[model samples]
Target: MTNTKRKWFIYSLVGIGIILISLLAYCIYLYQVINDSRTSEMDTTKTQLLEQTSYVDIHSIESFHGTNSYHVLEAMNEAGEDKLVFYPLEGEQRQLTVFDMEDMLSKNTLIETWQSSCGSCKLVNVTPALVEGEAYWEITYHDNENNYVMNYHSITDGSLQEQFKYPKMFY
Candidate 1:
């Protein structure tokens, strides 16, 4: 091919390569934006639920028979509302009001404050009484026919410890 023709061909190939790279980068950027938007949306929705809700009733906390396993059940309730008539376990349980919920569900905190007797808990241990080092949470969300449930499972010293998950959707 002539020198002029070869130069034009080379320039054309370079231009096409640049265009392709730019398009690929834009697509990747768009995907990241959409993913981040979904995460932010979920966080906002969770905060709104926390604002409108009130309290949680921990129903059962039991150790698996002859095993280092345990389970806990809790129900979230609106403050100042009376729905059930179950016997008290310890002292009187207090309902969390809107204001209280706001404070507990603050952002940047991995664990909610109301999940424990004290507001302080390690991220590794789902239980407040125990402290963990390397173990972390393995979260699972299930939507069964009846209800939406979540579980935060952690393993420490070969024992499985679980924490109750709040309802995803409120009535």
Candidate 2:
């Protein structure tokens, strides 16, 4: 009877292990589905973007989510001038706006400002964003304490627009 009870306990543990593995697999599947959906939406936008814009070559496309969401495209025009195209996402109450890269404040200047403010922060990315019809450089970084920080600065004038700092939840 004792041997039988031991076998039952082992079986129960194996069953629990299987269940955990299955749950992990399902979670991974869900993450992939969400990521694919996001990329597919951008693919659809690029199709429409080519039709509505005159950019000769599209270098990169990045999605920015904030009070206003947009697909910011870095492209080159006919005269070989680099341009930043702000294509408003569907359901957004905004029109397409494009800017000559030269018209905007340089990324280097934005980084310089970020460094002056937080000398110990480690930068993640400097993304171009369009917010409420205004162009901004969205800076993502990790503070000295490893807190996630997002700083938005006006691309037109190189002034701080907004900032959010998210503290690290775990060591």
Candidate 3:
């Protein structure tokens, strides 16, 4: 309409744009901060394993957070044997638990055991995990109804220890 009204409208639009840009920048910064903390934890676990155990090499490390925090490293021992190193983050005394991979049930075998009962579910990746100092294989998958599921099975006996399911909220 008038020149003064158009100027006011443009100023309002600029202010809103500035606010949105600031919000986006803050979210990106927050995400980076959280990611850095997790990466640092993984690095600390690797250093601890190398110093405190006979493990000579690490193939991979997976971070797990539940009742407790843990970093599970697929590693090799001084005797050239594949091992799993579990380093717990919470406790008065934190000790590294080194397990022989051969002694534990294989991922394929464990997956087969679960698959037999959940034929219609879709399997996701399985990672080595620890619960209260005991070693377990954590399996993540989507059920037939599209609900997210987590099944923790004992590595020694291949028995299910616990399961957590999260139903999808949005279509």
Which runs of model 3 end up more than 4 angstroms from their true locations?
A: 112-119, 156-161, 164-171
**Pairwise lDDT winner, candidates 1 and 2:** 2
lDDT of 2 by residue, 78-103 (tens): 78999898877866555778899989
Candidate 3 residue 106 C-alpha distance from true site, Å: 2.9
Whole-model Cα lDDT per candidate? 0.38, 0.86, 0.88
lDDT of 1 by residue, 13-40 (tens): 9999999999999999999999898556
lDDT of 3 by residue, 76-159 (tens): 988899988778888968877779888999988998888999999999879888777788889999999999999999998889
Alpha carbon lDDT at 70, candidate 3: 76
True-structure Cα RMSD, model 1: 16.3
RMSD for each model, in Å, please? 16.3, 2.8, 2.7
Candidate 1 vs 2: which has more TM-score: 2
Candidate 2's error at 113, in angstroms?
4.7
Ranking by lDDT: 3, 2, 1
Q: How well does candidate 3 match the true structure, expressed as C-alpha RMSD?
A: 2.7
Residue 23 in model 1: lDDT: 100
lDDT at residue 17 of model 1 (Cα atoms): 100
